[model samples]
Target chain A: MADPLVIRGVSIDDTFAEAFPMRGARIILTAVNARWARIAAHTMTGFATSVIGCKCEAAIERELGPEDTPDGRPGVSVLFFTPDSASLQQRLIERVGQTILTCPTTACFDGLPDAPERMPVGKALRVFGDGYQSSKVFGGTRYWRIPVMEGEFLIQEDMGKVKGIGGGNFLILAETAEVALAAAEAAVEAMAGMPGVILPFPGGIVRSGSKVGAKRYKTMIASTNDAYAPTLRPITTSDLPDGVNSVQEIVLDGLDAPSISAAMRAGIDAACRLGVIRITAGNYGGKLGPHHFYLRQIMGQPTA
Target chain B: MTDRITITFDTLPSGGEGLELDGITPDRLLTLSNAEIAKLPVWMGRRSVPLGDIAAIQGELSAHLRFEGDLARAEGVGAGMASGVLDVTGSVGDGAGVAMRGGSLRIGGSAGMRLGAALPGASRGMLGGEIVVTGSVGAEAGAYARRGLIVVRGDVGDSAARGLIAGTLVVFGRVGADAGTGNKRGSIVVLGSTAVPPTYRFACVYRPTVLRVLFGYLRRAYSIPVADRFVAGRWKRYCGDISELGKGELLTWAEA
Candidate 1:
C-alpha cells in the first residue's frame, strides 16, 4: 500500500484532479454604477451552472473599478465556458442580448483582446437597432452602437475566445456536516475574485457530487457518487474515512492551468481547518483527461 | 535618432513659387545616397532644378524627416505619403498631405489652401493616416477624406469637411461657414463656435462613447488640449447634408 500524507494537521490524499478541454471567453460589462453592472453580470451568469444541463457555465470573476474599463464606468468581468467554439458563440449572443442589452445603463466590451479566436457577437446583436445601428472604430477596434429607447447600447463587435480547462476540483471530508460546510465556505471566500477562474455554482460548494454513469439506468449519463456518500459507506466500497460523515466538493473553471492551480492552493489551504478529516480530489484514474493536478505535488509548492 | 533627413531652404525660389517635392518622402529618399538625393529633380514653375541648388540637405537616410525655413511657397510637401514621420517647422503652401495613404504629418505652422484635399483629378483625399496641424488650416480641409483622422488645434476656414465620404475631422477652434454641406457618412466634431448649416437637422443631446476614446487619443498622442467639459459633458448631434446621403453627423459640444 502507498504511504499516507498530512498537511497542517490534516490528511492529504495523493490522487489528482482530472480536467477536460473547454472553450472559454471573458467579457466586461460596464454600467453607470457598480450596482447595475453587478445586476447585469448576475443575470447573464444565471441558469449557467454546468454544461451538462445548461450547455454552458459562467460566473462573475471579479468587480472592476472605473480605471479597469474602457469607458471609465464601474464594471464587472465574467467568464464563460462551453464544449466548443460554436457553442460558446451561441451562448454569448443569446445571453448578452437577453440580459445585458436589455439592462439599463449597461454596455459590453471584450475582456480577452489577445485571444486568437474572435466571435462576432456585437454585430449579430446590432439587428435590434432595425437598420438604425451604427459602428465606429477606435484604436483599431470596432464598436457597435444600438439605439435604445432609454439611450444607446454600446458593445464591441467581437468577443475573444480561447481554449481553457474545466472541471478542476477538490473535495473536503469532515467528521460532521456543520464542520464540512463551514470549511467549504471559508475555502470559497479564499477563492473569491480570482482573476482567471470562476466558481460556477451556488455558494461555490456542490454537495451533490456525480459519477460518470448510472448502474441500472443505461440512459442516464451520470448518477450519484455513492462511494463518497456517507450513508453508502457500509453498503458499498466507500472512499470515505472511518470518522467522516460529510463531504463538500468545490469545482473551478479557469482560463489556464496556472490560474486553476493558484486557486486550488489557496482553497485547499483555507479548507484544512479543525475537525477536517482529509483533503482529496476527484478523478478517473487519468484515463479520461489530459490535465492532471496531483494534490500532494500542488500542496508542497510555495506558489502556483 | 537613426539619422533623420533634414531639408533646409538656404535660399528661396527666385519667383517665390518654390519647388514641388512630393514624390521624395524619407522612405523613398532612403534608397539613394546623399549625392543621388541632391541630384533629384524639383519642379519650380515650368522648369526642373536640382534639389542641391535650392536647399541644404544634411543627416543620414532614415524614415524621420524635418523641414526648416519658410516653405509657404513650397507645394505638395507631403502629398501621397505612405508611411513614417514628416514634421514641418514653417508654413506650407497648397496641396499639403493630399491623398495621404498612411503615416503622420505634423505642421508646426499654418497650412495654405487645399490642405489634405482631393487631387486635381482623383476623387478621394487623405486615404488612411493622421494629420495634426498645430495652427489654423485654409479652406476645404479634408475635402474628400475617405478613411482617416484630422485634428486641427486652431481655427479652420470656410467649407471644411466638404464632399466628405467617410472619416473624422475634429476642430478645437472656430469653424467657418458651409461645413458639412456635401458630407456623407462622416463625422465633424466641433468643440468651438460654428454656425450649423440649415440642411442639418437636430438629432439629440447625448454622450457618445466613441468620442471618449478619440478625445483621449488626441490628448495622449498629439498633446492636444481637451477641456474636462467636453469629456464629461453631453453633445448636440446634427445629421447633415440632406441633399446627400444625410448619414453624416456634425456633433457640437452642448453647453451647460
Candidate 2:
C-alpha cells in the first residue's frame, strides 16, 4: 500500500514500545554562547553512554530559550538518571562540580521541582571554598557564592530529584551496515532534541544490544542479542528475515511513558523507508519492567 | 515531634546563667527522634538539666522549628545553632548565636544585650549566621561579628557594633547613637536615620552592591518585606572606626 514499506524486501514489522522506572535530574550548561554551551554539555555527557556500566545514564534533553534560563543565555538541558536519590545526588554533584561549575557563564539548578525529595547538592559542595564562601537566599532557596579566578560562581542550594523511565528502545534491521547506519542516523536525527527523551548511545546507534542473560557465561547478566544478527542466521534461531543482512538499535530514556512513546513513534515512522527491514523491540517476555509498548499499538494499531 | 529538645520554663530563673551553645549544631539535632534528643544536655540556673526538663517537644526535628512561650529570662535560645530554622515565639534573654557559625535565629520579641555578639574573652561574636529580632534589642546587636548577618526589624540600643570585626547589620527602625563605634571592617545598613558620630567620615553616595545580595537573603531566608527603594535607592556610605582598621562602613539611605 505504501510502496510495500520494505527495506530490502524485509517486511516492516509492527509492534508497540516499552519502558521502565528510574530517577532523573536535568543539568543545564551555559557559556558565552552556543559554542561553549555545546562544549560543556558534550563534556559533561561524555563517557556516559549507558547505565549498564556507567552506573548512571544521561543525554541532552533539549536546547532552552534564553528567557528560560537563569543567566538569560543559550543553554542545553541534560537529563541524568540513577536508581536512587543518594547516588543521583552524588552523581550530580560530581558531574556538575567538574563540568558546569568549571565552565564559564554556567550555573546549575534543580530541573525537577515537583520531586518530593529535595537534595542538598549545592549546600554540600559549598565547602569547597573552605571558609570564604558566602551564601544568599533568594525566594527561600539558598545559593552559594564561591569565589573563582574569574568571579564568584553562584549555585542553587538544592536540586530536585524525580523518578523517570529508562530502557525504552526499538531495533532497525537493514540489508547492510550502510543502510543500517543511515537509518539509525535518520532515526536519531528525527528524535534529537525531542522533549523529555534522550538517546544515550554512541552516535545514537547500538550494535551490541543485549538479551537478559547469557547462555555460555554463567555469571554474565547479559550477552549479545543474537536473534537479529545477520551472521548468526544460519547457526541460530535468527529473527532477521532474508535480505535483512544488518541491523542497528536506538535506545531511549525519558521522563515518563508519554515521552518515550512520542520518541518511539517519531523514530519508527522515520525508519520505515527504503532499504529498511522490519522494526521490533527488546523485552523479556513481558515478565520484567512494568511498562510495555507494543510496536503495532505504537504504529496506531491494536496489539495482536 | 521535633528531634530538637526545646525547654519552656515553668518558672523564670532569677540569676543569669548566661547559657552557652558551643556544642549545639542544628544539623546534629534536627533529624533525631524525640527519644534521641532527650539525652542532650543544657544548663539550668546553676545546675545542668536534660533538654527534656523544660519545653514540651512537638513535631519532628525538621529543618524548621518553632518554640513558643516567654523566654524573657531564658538565655542562649539559639546559641551555637549551626544550620536549621530556629523560631523563638517570644522574647529571649541574651547571648543568642554567641560564636554562632551558621543558621538562622528569629526572635519574635526583644533580645538582651550581646545578642549575636562575642562572648567575654572571645575576639568575635557570631562567626556566621543570621539573627533577626522583631522587637527592640538592648545593645550591641552585632558586636564583633566576624562574618554573618544581623537584622533588627525594631529599634536597637546604643553601641550596636562596638569593635565589630566584620559582618553586616540592617536596622529598619531607629539605631541609637554610636551604632558603629568600632574600629574595624563591617557594614551597618540603617533604614532609619540617626545622627552619625564625629569619628565617622562620609565616604560616598552610591547604592551598594551588597544590598542586592543582602536584600535577596532577607526576602528569601526570613520572609522579610523589602521596599523597592531599599533595593533600588542610593546610600550614604560613612567609612570610619578609622581609629582601628577603618574598614567598616555605615550605609544610610540617601533621600531623593
Docking outcome class, model 2: incorrect
TM-score of 1: 0.88
CA deviation > 4 Å runs, candidate 2 = A1-14, B1-256
Cα lDDT over the full model 2:
0.75
Interface RMSD, prediction 2: 5.9
TM-score of each: 0.88, 0.59
Report lDDT (Cα) of residue B221, candidate 1.
70
Question: Candidate 2 chain B: minimum summed lDDT over ten consecutive residues — where?
Answer: B16-25
Q: Write the residue-wise lDDT of candidate 2 on B13-104 in tens digits.
A: 55555443334445667777776666667676677777666656655567666667756876777776778877777888877767777788
- TM-score of chain B as predicted in candidate 2: 0.88
Q: Each candidate's iRMS in angstroms?
A: 1.9, 5.9
Q: Of the true contacts between chains A and B, what fraction does model 2 have?
A: 0.03
